[model samples]
Target: MHTDLWNYALALYARPGVEAACLQLQEDGADVCLLLCASWLQARRARVSDERVCALLALAEPWRIEVVQPLRTLRQQWRMAAQGDAALALLREQLKGLELQAERTLLERLQACSQQWPAGSDETADDWLVRLAPDLCRDHGALDQLRAAASALQDAEDGD
Candidate 1:
């Protein structure tokens, strides 16, 4: 499995609308990360799949293909064509873009979820979400909007 791609999807899982999409995809027996990676790979014109990635690399069946194959391909190509630094550099840039998008999406989701938290419960809402889905909140990073929501709730509680 491509660790980078997996991390990217894991980050995206914290996004708004992504959890629902991920749940639906999960229900359909698809790895959400793999799907996201596939989308990235498709955009990059990389002909790869989670299945092929697992088969070739002996990684988990539901691994992210986008991260692995392109890197692997780049490495192989670089080995064959030592002067192909440009191609490798391009692939790295694209991966960085994907990472940034994933991070932004995650922050958006966290903000949305925090906004939708029930009134009269600042820490409670965060706790509930953390309990319900730890992966989304596990050191995922500070969401300033969510923090504001929590702060507002705390103030309300103090006023009461």
Candidate 2:
């Protein structure tokens, strides 16, 4: 049985350094959701292409900018005030949850977009990440950490 993208993301994110790596990537203007999808695609050995990447971006960019980014911005904006105010902290937590949910929904949409693409690719093993990751993140050690974690996650699952 194949693992769905959400679960795969959760498991991968739970891995050591992955969360930090993702955050670092996000800081560098990379989309964590896109990176996760890239890792998942590589793990599944799915084919990678310009059209497929474009399709994923086309489906995800608006949702990220309009939905995820706003919630995340609000949460970040409240970080300091929320630190001192209990009620504000609660609201910020709620906002954080909403942001998470928005990202999850984006992941689900991405999965749906690529679900029909068959596993097994003519592309190189790293092609998915290489293509999907932001150029700014291309040489970051955080990116390497994510790549390592994804590989370890794939090995652990295959061992199951």
The candidate that wins on lDDT is 2
Prediction-by-prediction clash tally: 2, 0
Candidate 1's error at 25, in angstroms?
1.5
Can you write out model 1's per-residue Cα lDDT over 91-141, one digit (the tens) per residue?
A: 666765664464345333332323332233222212321222224432333
How large is the C-alpha RMSD of every model relative to the true structure?
Answer: 15.6, 1.4
- C-alpha TM-scores of all predictions: 0.28, 0.95
Which one wins on TM-score?
A: 2
Model 2 sits at a Cα RMSD from the real structure of: 1.4
Query: Which stretches of candidate 1 lie above 4 Å from their native place?
Result: 1-3, 49-58, 62-160
Clashes of 2: 0
User: Which residue pairs come into collision in candidate 1?
Assistant: 15-109, 16-109
In candidate 2, the residue pairs with backbone N, CA or C atoms under 3 Å apart (3 or more residues apart, or in different chains) clash, namely none
**Scored by CA lDDT, what does every candidate get?**
0.39, 0.88
lDDT of 1: 0.39
